[model samples]
Target chain A: MLSKDFVGGLITILLGSLYLFFAFKQRVSALADTVGPAGMPKFLGILMLSLGVILCVQSVVHSLKTNAPALVEWQGEGKRFFRAFGLLCLAIVYLVLVSILGYVLAITVLLTLVALYLGAQFSGQLATIAIGGAAILWAIFVLLLDVPMPSGILL
Target chain B: MDTILTLLPDSLNFYLVLPAILGVAWGIIGGSLPGISPSITMALLLPFTYALEPSMAIVLLASTYVGAEYGGSIPAILIRTPGTNAAAASVLDGYEMNLQGKAGLALGISLYSGVIGSFVGLFFLVMLSQLLAELALAFTPPAYFALGILGLSVIVSLSDQSLVKGLIAAVLGLMIATIGTDPVSGISRFTFGVSGLLPGIQPILIMVGLFAMSELFKQASILEDLRVKTSPRIRFPEKKLRKRLILPQSIGALFGGFEGVMPGAGGTIASFMSYNEARRWSKSKDEFGKGSPEGIAAPETANNTVAGTSLIPLLSFGIPGSNSTAILLGGFLVHGLIPGPMLFARSGDVVTDLYAGLFFAAIALFFIGYAIMPVCIWLVNKPRPYLNAFILALIMSGIYSINNSLFDLSIMLVAGVIGYFMRVMKFPFLPTVLGLVLGFMIESNFRRSLLLSGDDLSIFMDDKISLMLLTFAVIFVFGSLAKRLIQVLRAGT
Candidate 1:
């Protein structure tokens, strides 16, 4: 099986190809005008294409030469990945709901959800994390730093 | 230097007192915490400085920069976990000495080296930056374009696993850079008619996204498995280890200074290189990887040394030496201060205050270093899952607070996703961000240089400095290609 490195390389190469195509179209202006804005991009597009070719060649060579199967290792925890992703989604939802529910309420709920989702090891640490996060945000942004955060109608 | 001194007297009362104490405390706490960088601390404090007298604000920011470098060493020596990337090298020998029961000796060596490097770098920053700024007055648009290209070439050395992927990411960043308004021709390349894209992406938001928020996204994914399981034990170093560390630390500081002067080389490079150098030069090289005092001393000294002198280019020219300094540039701009020759002549008071603060900040760091060492050791060695979650929460809140814009939050999430994939594939992300920042600088300068010379291609080759910079860029690119070729040949063999 091909490794993540190999797959990632292929993906990048495809993206580079699309960019190169657009850059080539723009190069007509570079050829016609003096100091065309397209010169650098055209140069970069060609350079990227060359790099993409090299990576593709290297990946093919590695696939051919290796006798043993490509190693697949999970670098770290799957549970952690899910928890972080879930919390991130919750943040997005909070952002969307903040306009309707108000900034303070949305942030308070988001903090509580994130603290719990992050798996605070201590029994009542969830409350501490939530309160602490909210307090710090309020003090730093709302009061001192003067950044405008959402204020819910309830607040 | 005379100009800097003349303005020192007028602001003596304000610059000397409060900023020093506040800066040192901030540095200690920020430095002790893993993943908190001094640059971010300065950026957060930047907005408040707008309300203060110029001298006071600059003084406070400079002090924080110096104090943070020393603060990072505490955790490295105690827990075998470095608080910042710069301190990562220190853990090798420092933790080994701790295992052998000589934590005090290791701490002593780190403190001593930190002070020495700080003093040396300060002396150079004061003297050399002034001299360079004078020379920088002669720089033209063509010169800046060449310098930008040279800076971008440094990315080759930074690519971790796949140079190809790194190059692609860099090019992509450069493309994104073209999306804003063009300075010379006034024709936007890819702004796509979005009014918000007119001013281009702010450097602070990009950095906050690239460094801070993206980091939290990746950390969040690892929150489940990141349990603090280490048992805490502290012991002062033996007399023998103390004697052994002095020479190694000195050697590390020398390389650290060299790294600082070179643009694009930051703490990570300095620490790793100096650590390896110390091992190579040591009598008990085999003790390295296992536990050696020299291993820790070399890297700790180098990291701090690099941290101070890295400001040389940022101050002397308008160029940033590292990611941290790039963010610092935003702070400088926030105060309506441009960092080059204009500031030297126009805002001399601010310059003097910054210099004074930097000098005292190093001194203040020594005290903070000792006081916080024990706590840092405990924090790292003691397992506390709750603290990690707290840190994660802090990172999220801090990033969100920077720009109340929901769009920036989304950008942060997208950058985080990109960062995660890059890290997993062993592709270097630093180069991508650096390329992005430098891309606009290069494009604007290149176009202006062309327009200045009536599109003459000979102008780039005409200037001596531009010639030298382009030469270096060619060498770096070819050198990267050669290395890849050699690797391929070895693989074939």
Candidate 2:
């Protein structure tokens, strides 16, 4: 039920407070000595805190002035939400695998997984998919131009 | 004359013959493929140009730019999907004509208008680039810093709906840029004691993730079957459509050229602005969304025209007119050619070749874009979803291959997530990229200028150029605020 503006303002205020804490620490130094390291940060901190306060105030004002749109309740039935989340997971997995399995192998597996998740019709043919995907990847990175992918033992 | 004559032999072989052909070919391929943009092609080609002669390298890059703009129309006319973001405006009427079995005619008109618009845009590029080249010689560090900041300010208008989010993203980008080591004092700001962060994130990989990977993530939701079965019906338009299209095309061309002249405004803005004007001024305003040919012609003409005009600021002053032009800056450095005031004095022949190449590229794109578009439609409209997956893999691999570093890949991933979030929030992603790209330049210049002035703030106001840049930045920010206020008032009423 929380408004995006409210959430955004809360985060800004939290970040601004952190900045202010840092700014205060820098304030103990002499003004001339402080100018180089802390001048911009201190100025930025005050500005950020002021902006955060303004945002918080604006969100409250907007809510009071107009009827807020009802937040859309998350429906548990959506495949899309899971699929997007899965993509982030896959990317992270791919990143970890890249060094061990080699870049080319890791990329191939990631692409196949993504394509399958997208419910691609071409997934019916397993070998064809791998060959086709690998060919395109090789052409772009290896043949057409020399991009140094981790060949490792796979080459 | 003697120097010109001596350089002529190498220029003829490398600049004229080789680069022009390569540029047109790349344009046709880039344009024909849906989602593969000219800017991407330019960025990809940038590394290869590093080993080539500066004059030839520049010519190739410039020609590719010109060709890609015109080439985007091929897919837009023959199929419903635009080949590039710039061609999105053309899809309304173009696909309508295609459905009506007039694909050939739509393509012909698109090619004709693109050629005409590009010529007009090039005239401005030539005239303005030369003038700015002279003015650029006087540029001070403060002026450059102001120019960079002003460039980022223009992003407020890029997505007017989420100006706050855009500014946040831009500021975030600047903050991120402050990582590694301070330019003035070599103190680490936010590198977390990592040596990799010392060099900072590379621009190419960031761009790849921001535009390409983020788009892939978003497209994951579209039904894969929807991409597989649509038959692209293309037909050439007849006399009636031509008559309606001509007036709007000419009208759009004028504004399009003007939009191109301004930094940060590119085809998307030009097309949107022209489309609105065309609707407001048209005799048959009711037929706009209903596949009016004028709708297609107006935006299409302006979009391509903006491409040629975008080069003006880039070549003349080293200020990028758009994101793609910013990417092309990599090419500038890679080829050992700097693109500021000294560019003209150092490499006049290269600049002239670029100018001439753009003109020729416009003509080549017209011929190639028209003739090969139908085939391109057939190729791009393949109903295979795995093909897209394959291409996506290739693109990602290409990005990885560039630096061969896992660090850059991680940066790309982070940027993609940020870009995706920014998109959902209606935050303009381009400005963030612009800010990240220009942040170091702005910061370094600001420091240098301050050092030069001995902490005198009057140095910024005293210089004519610096004052002009600061004034432009002020006007852009204020004007955006005023526009938002007006919109808010209208909504209230």
Candidate 3:
């Protein structure tokens, strides 16, 4: 398995490079001022690049010492990686549905899905908690607090 | 003093009192849980403050910060889980005291010590803040800029384990901070013409994601059920032990105050340092780790003491010395109040109200913590999965409530993912938030100072205060490096 640092370092390196590429492409002032709009980003980009390189070196040494291969380590952590990835995907889908289904209905569904994913029993308690919790939150936010909630066709 | 007294009564309307209770109560529950910190609890609740009157909102957040300090000690004494980072040192003796069947006495000591710490901390806070505010009145733009850099320099001491990774996180934050329109040139840098990007990332959004959502995501994988249950009781100390506590509590108060005033030295450091100092001054030195009242009292007092006094920097100079104060800064800004010396002149009444509110919070913490410690003990026995899910739902709802924008939700989700991964990779999250908070200030001031000087780099050097502040930054960064190099060199031999 690859050490965690190696993956982090690699991602940081790519991100730093991306920032620098865009920063250099940016249009600053017509007077070509120093420390202008591009200056902070550019400075940050270079700083990240150097730091990423150091992180990469340190992680590589750590990986060598620990005998962990880069690609295999990511593939090895199946349950953890998948749970996190699944949760993110679930959030995205729920968010997309929020405007259409309204927050209350959508959040109830989101809670149910989350409960199931977390391996909670499919009991009436689950239903009550999900629905009741959603309603209470809705009331607190939309009614009392006067925050406008997105309502869809069905609602 | 008279002004504060007069304002205090008016500030305690039901609108304020009710939220203060809720905030303190909720803060206790959140802080007693294993994974949640005081700042995270405050972050999760930050969005709700938008609907509140500024005074009520500020009081709610401030009081939560207060209540969480005592709450963090519950699990420390019970399960040996350092509920908050600052409570880590308390665990050694707290859990030991629990084992010795003095759980009630230990609980009492923590409560007493915490209240006493808050009392002393309040004294320091009220006295020092005015003086700091007076001093801040003299600062120019250059000095403010230098102060921002000085705040960032804290990452050196904060990230003792990995400076490189810390720098990377901070730089990323600074980069993200540059996403909105440039404050100086009135030109957009990285917004990509998106409407939401135009106003820049809201600190509230970043705070919510960085602290709450990210923590939720991290807990998703490692969630465990707590089967341990103990019905604990509380008993106030005897006269002798109470006398014993005075030495440690005083030590805690003194050390905690000194640490709180210095940027980067936060409650965790203060707690541990006070624990050691208390031991050094104690007659029963060997009892340090073995159910010593001084052990629990000292650290608990110290960490709680930090809750009030850490605001010295934040209230005085608008420079957040730690993560909690940084969140407090967000609360201040949300209410159209900028923290600094001008706050006294522009909003003296509000400042006085805050002092009054803090006093109330300190008192509220004692009663609330006293009532809830046993409830927390019972709650800890409940299913962890269920608790975690409920908390996650709270986080999502809170994020959505802000502006009701899908874009803000997306930012939160992305930030959560970023934060979760940052944790998985052992990266420090606080520095990133700090960098984001201070990045704009640092850049704008740097640019503005340069622009005024017609691009002369010597302007920063010529300004005495800026020079001294920057010099400290340079020294801290290099001094840390030198210390590390010497260690590496010595190890090689």
For each candidate, give the TM-score of chain B. 0.81, 0.85, 0.93
Off by over 4 Å in 1: A17-46, A67-84, A121-123, B1-24, B35-65, B223-246, B272-295, B333-352, B374-404, B475-493
What TM-score, computed on C-alpha atoms, does each candidate reach?
A: 0.84, 0.84, 0.93
| DockQ of the two-chain complex in candidate 2 | 0.34
> Candidate 1's C-alpha lDDT?
0.67
lDDT of 2: 0.68
Summarize candidate 1's per-residue lDDT along B94-136 as a digit string, tens digits: 7777667676777777776777677667766777777876755
Ranking by DockQ: 3, 1, 2
Q: What does DockQ give for each predicted structure?
A: 0.41, 0.34, 0.61
Evaluated at residue B318, the lDDT of candidate 1 is 58
Give residue B25's error in model 1 in angstroms: 3.7
Worst 10 contiguous positions by lDDT, candidate 2 chain B: B225-234
* CAPRI-style grade of the A/B interface in model 2: acceptable
Selected candidate, larger lDDT, 1 vs 2: 2
Clashing pairs in 3: A2-A69
Which candidate number would show the highest DockQ if scored against the true structure?
A: 3
Give me the runs in candidate 3 sitting further than 4 Å from their true place. Answer: A29-33, A61-76, B1-19, B482-493
